[model samples]
Structure formats: C-alpha cells, structure tokens
Target chain A: MAYSNEVRDSFSKELDGIREAGLFKEERWIKSPQAADIEVEFPAGAEGKKVINFCANNYLGLSNHPDVVEAARIGLGTRGYGLSSVRFICGTQDIHGHLEHRLTEFLGTEDTLLFPSCMDANAGVFEAILGDQDIMIADRLVHASIVDGMRLCKAMRDTYKHSNMEHLEEKLQDHQDKRIRLIITDGVFSMDGDLAKLDEIVALAEKYDAMVFVDDSHASGFIGKTGRGTHEHCGVLSQIDIITTTLGKALGGASGGCVSGRKELVELCRQRARPYLFSNTVAPVIVSGAIKVLDLVSATTERRDKLEWNTKFWRDGLVKMGLDIKAGDSPIVPVMLYNAKLAQDMARDLYEEGIYVVGFFFPVVAKGQARIRTQLSAAHDQHHLEKGLEAFAKVADKYGILGKSKKEIKEMYGL
Target chain B: MEEYKKAILEYVIKEYLEDDEDEEITYDTELISGGIVDSFSMVSLKRFLENKYDIQIPDADASPEAFDSVDKIAALVVRFKQA
Candidate 1:
C-alpha cells in the first residue's frame, strides 16, 4: 500500500471530521462556458438548469466575448497549442512579447514578466527578491498565495492589522533594524471588496524607506475610471515598487499571471524566477485572448461603466431590502448572513429562484462572518439585475432577514 | 492582573468587533476557538501585548491554545511579564 494502515485510518478520520463539521467543500459542475449565464449540471433527478451567474470573476463580461473567442481561435491556428518547452528553451514567442509589453504599458510599469498563473507569479517573486537581511510586513488579509510565497522566503515576517495603516507604520518602525523592509498588500480585498489605501501606503513607504508590492488580482482591468487598478484609483501608480496581477480574473477569465515592475526586476525574474524559468509559458490561446481583452477594455469604458452601475444598483437594492451588506464600492458585494447555516440556506434558495451565488463561511472567512458573495458583471442587463433583486427579496423574506434591524437580525440568528 | 485582563479584552473587542456596541462579550468568552479572534487578529494582539507588557511570547506558546481566551491570555501575559 502507498500508506500504512495507521496513517490511512488517520486520514479517513480527518475527512470524516471535516464532513461532520459542515466544512466539506463540494464542487458544482458547470456544463457551459463561464459567463453571466451558465448551464449547471444538477444532481440526480434534476435536469441541467441555466441560471444567472453572480459568483464568477467575469467582471467585464469579456470571458466568452465573440471577439476574444475569435482571437483565441486565430492564435491557436497561428501559434499552435502548447509550448512543450520552457521560456528559455524555445517558448518565448512574438505574441508573448506583445502581451508582456501591452501589460507593462497598461499598468504604467517599466517591464513585465509572464507566468503560468498569478499564484505561481506570487510564489516565485518573494523568494526571488527577499532574503535573511530583509523583513516583510504584510496586511493580515492578503491572499493565501502571498502568505505561501512569503513563507518560502527567508525574510522575517510580520502581519499587521488589515487595512490599518497605523499598525503597519508601527511594524515598520519595529523592523527598522533590518537591512531592507518590504511592505505588501492586495490592491483590492476580494472578500470585503475594499480597496487598500495605496496612496497612503506609498507615502508611508517613502517615509520608512520600504519597498511596496501590491497584488492587483481583483482590480486590474476595471477598477479605476480608465480601469488601470488600485494604484490608479489611489493615485499612486508611479510610486509602487512592484505589481503582481492575473489574467485569470478581469482580464479574460483565463489562467495566466504577470509581474510588472522596474526593468531590472523584470530581467532578474526572467532569469531567476523558478516558475517562470522552469514551467511552460502561458498557452497561446490564453495569451492572445488576454491581449484582446486588454485592448477591448482599454479602448472603451462602456463595459466598466455598466459593471459599476450594475453593482451600485444591486447593492442599493439589497440594502433597501434590509440586507446587511458589507460597505464597499467594488463589484464584489457580500451580503452578510452572520450564521453559516443561514448563508448556505439562502444560497440554495436563491439558486432555486434562478440566481446563482455562493455562500462563504468559516475558514474562508472568520467564524460567524458567513455571507453570500455576489459578483456583478457588465453582461447582466437591467432585467437580470431586477430579477436578481426579486430573488434576493424573496429569499431574505423567507429567512426572516428582511426589514429586521441589524440588531434584531443578529439576535434572531444567534450571531 | 485585572488591568492587564481589562486592557487585553478591550483591545480584542475593539479590533475584532470594530467597536460595534451591539455585540455583547465577556472575559471568559472563547477568543481563538470560538472565532472571535482569528490567526490574523491574534498576531496583532500578540504584538500589542508584547509591547505593552514588555515580554516575549515563546515559539512554543504561540498556538491558539496559548491565547484561546481572555483568562488564558491574561495568565500568559502575567507569566511572560514575570519571566
């Protein structure tokens, strides 16, 4: 056997515990492509259902756009499918260089390096730069990829209060004895849809002489007026030291990531970053499609404007219905349920009503902070928004979450 | 000891609850396990307590077990202060 009986028994017991604790994650299969509306394969006795998708990262609704799809098809015909070799060993192509250059231009950075995924980009950056002489101070709510990346490095690590600039300043002061200090944060916190105060962070970095790195995964393509990112929204695009983002979310809803920064850093990462040098480069289809996505988003702000308007409309509607929504301007709106069972029940009820959203609870978030995260897309029309609101109202009424004051809701839910 | 306990509990409530006056809490309430205080919050609390009490929390005592409740956290503070 691959494992001893004792070990296997322990593993089975752990899985049992997870199942009993209501923490077992079950994957729901989708039959159609990712978009505002998708066909989901239901379990036995239930036929496949087409539902309004409110949980995907398809913010700009360009994932399955006809133009992007056509671009990918042409790219596959021109460049073929897989690289079958790493970038150093015959993988770098003209399209890849074009994508990197376009990203650097779009992000207002000096250079950019591509990777298989944003997670890999994050995984490779920290270890490639920081060492024992450096110290890293990160926000408490940074993505798990960054936490793993920092762990792989030899730098002394400290986490400050989430979005608490004062706490960060104190940590920077405490670590002033280190040779170098790096401050890291996410451009937009996904769970809460809150933007980091990058302008303030940049000022503090200057004051403390620390380098700043931001993972702009959640805000790259459609955040600011021109859709630059948190840096643009916060007015510190030129001040950030390094930026890591993804093509997986707002760019194309495909899988790829990039690290954009100074020319020296990009050159260094190309030469030394393990994931970039060892792994196969991004697929031609994803690359070409992502390039098209950038062009489409940058050329016009119609999709971005529509997404923002839809988010505001839906968020205001939820609030008007007395739902306790987390306060933010990002399209990711979290309807706070407080109780795990209630969140799950609400998600199921909404799904039955033809609205698709996912419930998030403990481990993914803090305990007692259960919520239904609804992501808005430009693809959703006014009719879809109204229908989603109607579904939310019905579900909220059924759960006794409507018209109750925040206090009453908390008391009734035992929160 | 009473001062230390009061200070620690107040900080936890303010940090985690964001000064929300609606949620009632007590010193004996479970902090780490009950999820009122997560790992991230624990890091902030640890740093604050270390600075305020002038003590170092050893690596062995950094688990949720050490700072599970207000009472346990107070005791750890006292022990560290004495050490």
Candidate 2:
C-alpha cells in the first residue's frame, strides 16, 4: 500500500497522545440551525439534546434571520449558487461590485475588495502590500490569521505588548529605518473580549508615520453606537489605513470576508493578493445575504442595541455570582478556571444542564488561563439568559469554583 | 541581581512549565525557542518583571532574544533598574 503501516501507527500514536494530554477536540453534531437554541448530538450516535448555545460568534443573531434567509433565496434564484471562476475572470458579477460598494459605504472606507474568507484576506493582504523593506509590528495578542499573514510576507515581523501604546511606540521608533511600518491589531480581542485602544494606537501611528491595520471580525456588526466598527467606536473611522472583517459572524453568519481601506491599498490587493487572484469568487448567495445584512444594520440599530443589552445583562449576572471572568465591554466573556481539566469538566457539566459552552485551554489561550468563553447574542431573551445563568451557577457550585480568584483556583487545581 | 535570576527562574517554572514536573530549567535554559514559553506567556513574564522591579523595559529591549533564558531576563531587568 502507498500508506505504510509504520506511518499509520505513528499517526495513531500521536492521536492517542493528544487524547492523553486532554487536548483532543471532539465535534458535537448540531441538527438544528445555528441560533440561540440548538439541538446537539454528542458521542456520534447519541440522541440530540436541546440546549441554549452560548459559544457561537453570532453576536447580532442574524444567522437565521428570516429576512436575510429570503434575500439569500432570492439571490439563489436570480444569480444561481456558485461562481466557478475567479474575480478577474468571468466570476465578477454585478452583485459582487454592488456588495463591495455597499461595504465600502457601510464601513466608511474609500474602497473594498472581497475575499473568500477573512482568513484568506489576512493571508493574502500582507504579501501584496509589504516587501522586504517594510516592517509589520503587531500586537502580541493579535489573532492567529494575522500571524499567518505576517509570516507569508517578506517584511520583518515584530510585536509589541498587547494594548501597550508605549511598547508600540518603542517598536515604531526602532523600525523607523524601514521603508514602511504597519501596526496590526484586532478591534476586539476574541478571547478576552477587550476592546483595543485604537485612539491611542492611532495617535502613536500618526506620531511615528506608521499605518494602522485592524481586523474587526469580532466588532464589525455591532460595536459602535451606530454599529459601524471599532474605528467608529474609537472616533477614527476615516483614519484607519486597512480594516478586514468577516460576514461569517454577526453579519448573516455566512462565509465571506473583505479588505476595506484606502483605495490604493485595496487596489493593490485586487491586483496582487494571491487568494483573491487565484481562488474562486465568493458565492452569490453569501454576497446577496451580506448586502441585506448591511442594509439591516444600517437601517436601524435595534439588533445592535439588543446585543449590547444582552451582553451587559449576562456580564452583570456573571459578576454578581462572583465568578472569575475577564473584565471587558465586549460580549465575549471568559470565565476563568485556571486548570484545563477543571474547565473541561465544568463545560461537560454545563452541557448536562442544557447550557452549551466549550472549554478553552492551553494552545487556544495561554497556559494556566483555561476558561469557558461564553458569547452572548441578540437572539437570547431574558428568560434564556436567566436559565443560562442558573445553569452556570449550578455548574460552578459543583466545581467549587464560585467566588474563587485566578490565583486561588490555580492553587486549588495545581495549574 | 542573583536574587532576580532565581526569582525569574522560579516564576517561569511555576507558571509556564508547571505541568512538566520532570523538566529541568536553569538560568541558561532556552525558554522561547525551546517552546517552553510562548508569546502570550512572554507577555505575562514581562509584566511580572516590570511589576517586580518597578522598572520600564522598552519594547525594543523586550524581544524574545532578551527573554530566552532566566539569566538574560535578569540582565534585562537589572539594566532597566539601573537606568
């Protein structure tokens, strides 16, 4: 056989080692649509259990919105399902241009270019814009996709302390001899739910002649007062040089992303970005739904307001219960458990209580920072949240982790 | 300064390599390239040194090369302390 027994045994042993290390991830089957309440089946062949989902990135709860679904259906009928060619070829449709225009206006950017996903956008953007002479100084806690993108480019990669403007300034000063300096960060950190200090970053960037790049995947649909993005939230909407975001989360929960920023930069990506140049164009259904998503979010702030209220309510509840949670304003609340096994056990118990959550441990986060990352959504009503809080309280009580701080938990669990 | 090295080594072992009880870490042990300390841990380690020494180490001097070992980290802290 082409695949030898030795190689197969080695792979099996590796899998066994991962399981032994309590790091093997098993996927739960979701029979229902992505929403607040989902029917999940664990252990492969078991019966599905209905649970309230608290682990999805569905911030605005537009994933199964009826209107957006109808818009996608209309698009399917009018434009068909897939585009077999790349954008430069025959895949460029009128709807694609229309969606890009709408996104540009919605994000308050000069121009926009669509990509297959935000991962692809990050992967292709750096190599297209920067060369060996340039330097990319990123926040240490930037998303993994940005790291991959930085690796693909020839620019020298450096990092500053997370959200430390002084560190960022020092790095910028050190890189002044380079041709260009780009400061990259996430608008809202996904794990900690903390908002980036864009105002401070922009000030330092201006002082040092460095450009700013923000990946607003977690903050795009419902962050600012008017729900534009973190740039608008930080009062620097037009000042950002590059902003990349996804349509897969709060914006219709479909698969598409874009790089929006200065016209010249976007034009460069359109011409030279490998993902956009070589990969197939985004499907018409996703584009049509994303257009409707922009329309919905732009027309009113009802869903965004609901999401903000939900986040506040959930956070306040968790705090009142004395659970050790990350302090932040975004909806991604991480309840610290410190020990990886304890986090996993607590998540399993929470699942048993009909509240769906996942344990995040080392590799996903830092060592000794294991947590249950609960994401609130606009779809969750007061009743759902109350029940979810009750489930959490019960599970925390069972784990004897209520009111325990991080240090205390570590001392207790031996992290 | 020797105390600083000992404290740094203790913190690294307690925080980053706690699960590996058998792993031996000295002042000259590789922390970054050996994968014992990742970027995230390095941030916290920097913060720990800053808080412990009450000194500001500029990001230019906080590179992984400067933090690859307990001795290097102690030297960086002492430099900031005397500055």
Candidate 3:
C-alpha cells in the first residue's frame, strides 16, 4: 500500500514518454579501467567492444598511471581504507593535511579544504560564507552545482549572460547596495568547453569591491601554461577569493574535491561547511593518489603539453572534415548536431565504428542545441586521433551532415 | 511597440512552445513561472530581443518578472529603445 500501483503507473508512463522522445539515457558498461581505450558493452549484457574513448574528463591521462596507483596502494597500506568519522572528528589523517597543503601550493591559493566532491564543496561554500544581506551574481552558464549551492544560501541570486563582462559589470553596478556582492563563475564551462573571462571578471570585482569565486572543476588540470588552472592562465592567480576544483577529472580521476582560496574563507568553510562537518572524510587512498598527481604535474608539463597538442590536432581534423563544432581551445570539443534524435543516432553509429562519445541533448543543453561532446586526453596518441577522425567521418557521412551548419541540420531533422 | 509584442509572441511560440502545440499563448501569457520557458530560453530570448532591437537591455531590467509575458517583454524593449 505504501508504494501504490497508481504512483508506479504514472512514473512508468513518464519514463516511456522520455524514451519515446529519444531522451532516455542508456549507460554503456565499461569492463576495463578508465582509459583512452575502454571496453564497453551497451544494452547491458552484450559482447564488449574496445573503443577509443573521446568523452571522458581524463585530460592528462593520469587516471591509471602506475605511479598514482602505486601511491594509492601505499596509502591504503599506511593510512587504512576509510575514515569512519568526519574531518573535525577522527577523520583528520596526516595524509589529509598533507594533501590540503599540497593542493594549496599547487593551486597558488593561501589555503585549501577538502570535500567529498566538488559538488559538496560548492553546496557548502556559499551557505558558509554569505548571508541574507549579500547577493550572489553568477554566470548564467556556471555549473549546476553552483546553482544548487546558491539556492541553499540565503543571499539574493542573479546571473549575467555567459562570459558577458558588460552584463556582469551592469549587474555589479546594480548590486552596489548589498553588504557583499559575490561574483561566481566556472573557470571553464563544462558543456561548451569555453573558458571564462576571469581577468575581466577580476577587474570588475575589484572595481565594484566584490568577491570573486570560480569553480575550476573542468579546468583544474592541464588548462593553463603550467596547469595551475584558469586563474593562472588569466594572470589573476592571487586575485580570486574562492576556488573550488575537483580531483575527479584529470587529477588521477579517482574522487575528491576541494575549496582552495583565501585563508579566512577556507578556515570558515572548514569550520562551517556542513558537508565537511557531517559527511565521511575523503578516502586516504584518493588523498594519496591526488598528492601524487599534483607532484607529477608540478614536476613536468609533459602530459599537459601532449594534451594541448592532441586537442588541437583533433579539433583541426574535425574542422577539416567540415563538421560544425563548438569553437574552444580546451580538450572538450562538441560536434554540433542540433537535433536530439540525430545526435543520438550519430552517437550510436559512431559507437559501432569503435568511438565512444555521448550525445548531449535537451535538458543537458538548450533545446535544438544537441551535440556529441568529445574530450581529448594525453593518452590519445596520433593513432587514436586518426582512428577517431576516421570513425567520425564515417558517421558524419552516414548521416549526410558533413559541411552542414546548425540551421541546415535543424531543417533536415526537426528539433 | 505592438509590432515588437507581435514579434516577441511569434518567436516565443515558435522557438519555445513548439513542442506544446495544444497550449495557448497570448501577450499576457505567463512564460517563466508557468514553465513555458526556462532560464536558458529566457537568456536566449533576451539575446534575441537585444539583437533585433539593437539595444542593450541592462541586466537589472531583465528580471524574470519583467520577461514573464510578451506584453511585459515589449514594454521593457520600448524602455530600452527610448533610453
């Protein structure tokens, strides 16, 4: 009686509607470790096919590095597996402190505080800092985590057009009456793969006497000249007030995130962020692995350089084939398909051709803006790029969409 | 101004409410709160208006309340045009 048939029937009908609309997402089971080439089996139990993965956030190919794995093993042997308590309790391990300091030094921030994930860091940071007298002015295209975090806080929320410095400045001028005005933006937008105008944003914040916060989750590794992140790339390394980034992506691709920023703000989060106070601490294994990742990136920019070259090569290849792609300098590249069904069909066809990339459609993006988002990594060599290009060309040819613009695609397949 | 309202109405119906053919929309129809348009769509709509009118609408005047209906959107546009 608690779970009634009527409720179940309504839920079932909604799920069916999603499938009929071509919006139902199906997971492809990966049999091997996270890598550029992974064995995937779709529709659940079929045979696994090895495909060149172009949809992962593994920018530096450090996900399965031998040194990182060895460091994790050592951490497990030394620090044990899981912490039963939170950071304020018995969860504070020596390695945790070491990782925090290491991240502070790596990110060029005054201090850092670890979280279960970047999502948690974002969720807790806003509420920990701002109050009702303040306002949070964010970029419209900032990560969803930031949106949720702002909702949890009592501060007034407003958003400027994505990367529009003029609009941001106007918003800043509008909110001069507030006790504090916080400008929030992603260092790099994940879906569009576009970097934020952090230098302009920093200048605006300075002029308006506002605080600047950046969630560098997508740009934490292999983004700048030396991989210090967007702040470093924008020449505002010490000007940002708060920075939240993830260890989940290019930093060994295990799982951990942190808020690295001003010493007082970081201390405030450590003392007040609910997730840090209540949730279990990040595993020592992840912490140790992240330490190794920071050390590797700090030691040399070889992986970062390789990833940059791979992104350029892949982007040039796609462009040469006359496919419309979102213009970005990052490793994340999206091939614009426009229609949801076309994107889904193209992703399926590309999968059959031994390429692993996901179709992003409505809800994930705007209506009529569906695309196949492809990410490149240092692990992807010239051979992988060539093979990926071949597979994409075949798929594009199959759809007869080569050289077609978004308008043309929309006209062909109704969005 | 009436022409602006008509253009805004036509664009909203064609671009946003295309999937819901049965739904009726008018100059006073609720767009954001009624779920006919989302934040992303609103941003694009704002961009459309700016591009069409060749006027920059300040973010302060581009609130959800100001853009909830075609009549309100047109009024905002006129305010910017006059400014």
Candidate 4:
C-alpha cells in the first residue's frame, strides 16, 4: 500500500503533464471575506503579507453586505443551520415557503419550488415534466444542464442554431404534432454575453401550442425593469411558462435554485423532481438570506442599475481598445483573443498585473473562438473599472495585440 | 432467433460505438461496464431492442443481473421467449 503504483502514480503523472502544459488549475486560498476588494493567501508571501483576488462571482457588491449577513445570522438563530432532509420529507421550512411564494409573485408565476442548486433546478426539470411522447427543442448553445436534462428525458430533442429564431421555428414546425413540445433556452448566454431572442420564441410557442422554459441563471436579479429576467428584458414575461433561476449567481450568491411557473407545473415538480424528493433541503440561513436579497431587489433599484452602467462602460472601453469585445449588453463580456495559447497567455499577464480574469476556449466554446471572459461587478467603482481597463490596455499593447501603437489605434478610430 | 439476437447485439455495438474496429464484440460480451452504452444511451438502446425484437424489456426485466452485459441481455431475451 505504501508503494505508489497504479492509481496514485497515474494521477501524479497526469497532473505533471497538465503542469507541463500550463493547464493545471492552481486554486488560491482566499483569506479575506468576499468584498469589493479581496485578499488571497499564497506561498509567495512567505516573509511579507501579500494577497490578490480579482476573480469572483459576487457581482452585486453584496457578498459582504451587513444587512444580508445579519439576515443569514438571524435565520441561523431562529431556524437551525440545515434541515438535512428533502423538501417533501420533513425539510420544508416556513422561510422556504415564504421565499417560494415571494419568488412566484416577483416573477409573475403561479407557484415555485426550490432545488439544491440552479444546475439541479434545470437538470431535474425535463424528466419530471416531459416523457416519451414529449419533444424538447433547445437553442444550440443553452447551458449544459438543459442538455443533460433532455438526455434524461425520453423526448425527441433538437437543437436550433444559437439565438437563431428562424432555425428554432423550423424545429418547432417539424415537431408540431407531438403530444407536448417544450422550447428551452438560456436567457443571457453565459459565454458570449449575448441575449436570447425571447419575443420570437414566445411567438413560436403560441403558434405551435408548445410551452417555453428559460434557464435565466445569468439574467435573473438584473437585466430588466425590476430585474425579472430575459422574458422581462424582451417584455414577454407573460408568455414564458417555466422560469428557473439560481440564488447562487445574482440572488445574493447563496446555494439554492427555484423554478417559477404555473401552479400545476411547480407542484408537479415538487412531487416528482428527483433531487427535491431525494436530496437535502437548502440551509435555513441561505433561504433567509435569499429572502433578504429579493427584498433588496424589490425595494431599491441601485444594484441592477449599477451593474447595467458597469457593463456598458466596460464593453465600450474594451471595444475601443481594439481587442474585439463581443457586442452585447450582458455583464459576461468575452474579449476575443482568437487563439487558445494567446488567450491563456493574456490571462496570465493580466493576473500578474493584479487584474483577475479567466480565459475560455474549446471545449467550453468552439475552437478558434478563444476569449478572456471578464465578468463585470457592481462592486467595481469607476476608478477600479478604469484602472482594470488601463492595465488591460497596457498588457494588451505589451503583448502586441493592438497591432500598432495607441496613437495609431486612436488615429485609426479617429477618436 | 439466435441469429436475430446476434444481429441485434452487433447493431447495438455499431450504433453506440464511434469506430467499426471497436465493434468486434461477441454475442456474450459485456457492454455496460465495458463502457459502450451509458445509462442515458441504455434507454435509447432499450427502445431499439424492444422495437427490433418486438419484446418489451419490462422494468423487472431491466435489472443489472439480466441487462448488465450483452450476453445477459441475450439470455434475458431467450428466457422471455420461452415464457
């Protein structure tokens, strides 16, 4: 047992290969709380206190919000820490009920059911609702969870071209006579930051007697008046049948998900969903914190507005830098670098300069579509945004990505 | 009938696998843990088995002991035919 041979040696060998290729994920231990500015403890700071953290999913500047933290603590005191049972089996708390009901009202749905995560919320939905006789049509670039869900279901599945309504209509027409047809898509595409054309999807649903489902993981808690989701963004909130979202992304970055939809569908999912019936319920503190988040979203318009302003400002700045930032209003801005090595190298250079961002290429996106996915946060002030952009420009110029000098760049654009 | 079973096994191999060289499977060979058909793909292949043989692979008939390998799958089919 002491002699390393098969499994352990194989693991080390594989990891060494990854290390050689510069692909090993070196997870930094974050020391400080998730705040506007963060601190990470690394081995390099042996003699001195050195810290850095620029990559985080806490977009709305609320990870360290006093009120949200207090709400979580209060709920922990009032209702224990975790239930440790499924929602249907002695795990349903009053706060969970209140959150579900409030979310239903907030999203203009008749009912809602919480899940372990938004991934599960999307994953468990298909097999619960659709069966052998049903058909599921989805956008080509919908999230992985939706694709996995369809795989579990015995539905006739077809993927339309990404955000291409014409191709979606073609698939819908082909499946017009199916017993049930469900059209699914992501509201704000996570990779390119482009939005789904929900208005056309809604019209197609109506024309073909099909229902619509949207995994609004990226769109919820922002992107519209009152921050409903893609449906709200497209002014087709009433047409979408099933609207599922996560608490982890925008709703205070907690650990849960919920599906807001018609009363029958929501109740049916509660009864039949695998995770809801088998897995443990979310902790009471997380739910209570999520409730506070919903309240914050409803009461003040500050968070989402700030996020919108940041997105536009950053997108415009990156485009001006001549790095070919994908055109979109969503906060998931992909600054295109085209080659995998170039994208990864750029990410490394940016990290060294104290700006944390991640490079995504194949198989996350298509080959030759490599990009540095710079996620914007409401926590980032104008100064931080400007400094980050300037750092990006300086590094990008240093890497010779801008093709010529900044004077030539400005002159070419006539700025 | 045995020939039909062989053909069905070969067909399952051809359909599930990516390469024809990978399709050199005996009727008695194991396919599940051999990593040919996954759980989700098993559902579709089960549909094909039922349709091709005109036999419903019942829930009780779909246990690991009977459907775990292609040999076991064939044995289960023969047992069903006798019943």
Q: Could you say which candidate leads in DockQ?
A: 1
DockQ order of candidates, best first? Answer: 1, 3, 2, 4
RMSD of each: 2.6, 6.0, 6.0, 9.3
DockQ-based CAPRI category assigned to the predicted complex of candidate 4: incorrect
Please give the distance, in angstroms, between residue B30's alpha carbon in candidate 1 and its true position after superposition. 4.5
Count clashes in each candidate, considering only residues at least 3 apart in sequence or on different chains. 0, 0, 0, 0
Regions of model 1 farther than 4 Å from truth: A4-7, B1-17, B21-64, B70-83
In model 4, which runs have C-alpha deviations exceeding 4 angstroms? Answer: A1-4, A7-23, A42-54, A403-415, B1-83
User: Candidate 1 residues B1-83, lDDT tens each?
Assistant: 88988998888876666434455668888877886766645667787788888889976887898888889899999888888
Assign candidate 2 its CAPRI class: incorrect
TM per candidate: 0.92, 0.88, 0.88, 0.79
Q: List the candidates ranked by TM-score, beginning with the highest.
A: 1, 2, 3, 4
User: In candidate 3, residue A407 scores what lDDT?
Assistant: 69
Estimate candidate 1's RMSD in Å: 2.6
Error of 1 at B66 (Å): 3.3
lDDT of 1 at A351: 93
Q: What is the lDDT of residue A284 in candidate 3?
A: 93
Which predicted model would earn the best lDDT? Answer: 2
**Better by lDDT, candidate 2 or 1:** 2
Q: What DockQ do you compute for every candidate structure?
A: 0.32, 0.09, 0.09, 0.04
